[model samples]
Target: MKAMLEGLEYAPEDNAAATTAATAETVGYAFSSDHLRALERDGYVVVDDLISQDVARAAAASARAMYDRGVMQNLRQEGRDDDVAVLATSSLPAGDEFAGLRPCVEALLRVPDDLRRVVARVDDDALGADVVSKVRACRAPDRLMLARYGSESCRYVPHLDNDPSDDANDAGSPGLRPSDRVFTLIAYLNPDWDATRGGRFRAYRPGVAADAASPSDFVDIDPILGRVVVFDAAKLLHEVRPSFHDRYAVTVWTRGAELLPA
Candidate 1:
């Protein structure tokens, strides 16, 4: 497990204790069971109110400030006042800009621990325990913070996180095997998003009518504030729809190391 903590600068000893405490105290037994079932059947589940409103608002503000500053820097570089220049492009902020929002990031990373405890409480290994055990065996967890601004159009095309062609037997390949990508966590920050204002998270299950190798077989997920969506990253094809209003969120992938077998 020491290797699992490598390269993560924020993996402090106290943080580990806090994570364990949080997992025990805050994890929802009923919701975890239902969410695990949803992932197994439809490939995705929306966990409502995972974060409190105050925390979500702070995260949204941080993302907006960081994005706005980045866009301004790009504008200065281009020497243009045209709103079109800013509207047509997107930029990445320095990692430090998001450090304040680390709590949200940690919540996503610890899903395995939460699920494990939940399974213990329920005395079920059918789905939830199986998912957590597979995640633990693999041991490769990755995290990323993504921010999108008004009119910037950071819209992602429909796609699968893992290559559909790859399987467990073909281990040393370029892309992920089915077991590697156990979860895809997206924490939404926008509170007022409606049908008219887009940027919903969309997912598609296998064998669906419109199912291409791509994420075109879409199911729309509203970008509700304090909401977290977790899904089977390999099997669930999903995408971020274009936003009429500004939108931002942290997207993370939790993978297992056994799939890599390095």
Candidate 2:
């Protein structure tokens, strides 16, 4: 279990650590204080080479195998009329499509260890140290999922993932924080990538203007191998540009708990 992270420079705190316990294994990528501040203000931060090249390759290989088996479920944009995007789909860990993805999913869930540390810095008295544990126990399905973008036409338009009106939200459940998906972690497993290849992930600045129809300013991040993007989905707006090449990655959402009744 060696990490192959060369040619990538990061702060001392940016280095990742992993440990296996008797019951569960814990692997976390540490974010510097500066990075935490950026996330607090900008709503997103891209951590370079958070995992070893071998680990990323393994996740990608497993994902590709599952895709070849035709086990993943196709997902389309809420209002789109285009045909199903085989590459633009997700596979849940507990489902049949996840038979070969267990190890990768397990590694992904461990990311919460680092995420909890970051969240603890935000209003610690309010969120508390157990926020991550409580979130893991919530009724919401917070399973690890594989999101693949394989087609040139497959694109995700600018939108919030937790918008109540969206049919893909919490199965239309009505309750406190029905759309309270607190954070999102996307670990890129692609081997080779470039901006010209498309499938760039973009994050917009907050408070653009309520009257404005769309966000104007944003930062685009290339989905390079071993790069992990963490963002607060409840506050930031983002989307995936149409991808010309097949892309594979593991995505997980941290569900926020409701403190009071709706």
Clashing pairs in 2: 87-148
| Cα deviation of 65, candidate 2, in Å | 0.9
**Per the 3 Å backbone cut-off, how many clashing residue pairs does candidate 1 have?**
4
| Candidate 2 lDDT by residue in tens digits, 1-262 | 0121111221111221232132233333445545655666787778874566776776777677666756566654462222321221123323333343444444445554555455555555443333334433332223446667775656677777667676656664432233756667788878888876788887888765333535357878888887888776666778787888887777766555352233
The model with the greatest TM-score is 1
| Root-mean-square deviation of Cα positions for candidate 2 versus the true structure, in angstroms | 9.5
What TM-score should be assigned to candidate 1? 0.69
Q: lDDT at 141 for candidate 2?
A: 28
Superposed model 1: Cα runs more than 4 Å off = 1-9, 12-17, 26-31, 71-99, 123-125, 128-142, 149-154, 166-180, 209-218, 257-262
Badly placed stretches (over 4 Å) of model 2 are 1-29, 79-103, 118-142, 165-178, 209-216, 257-262
Best by lDDT: 1
| Model 1 whole-model lDDT (C-alpha atoms) | 0.58
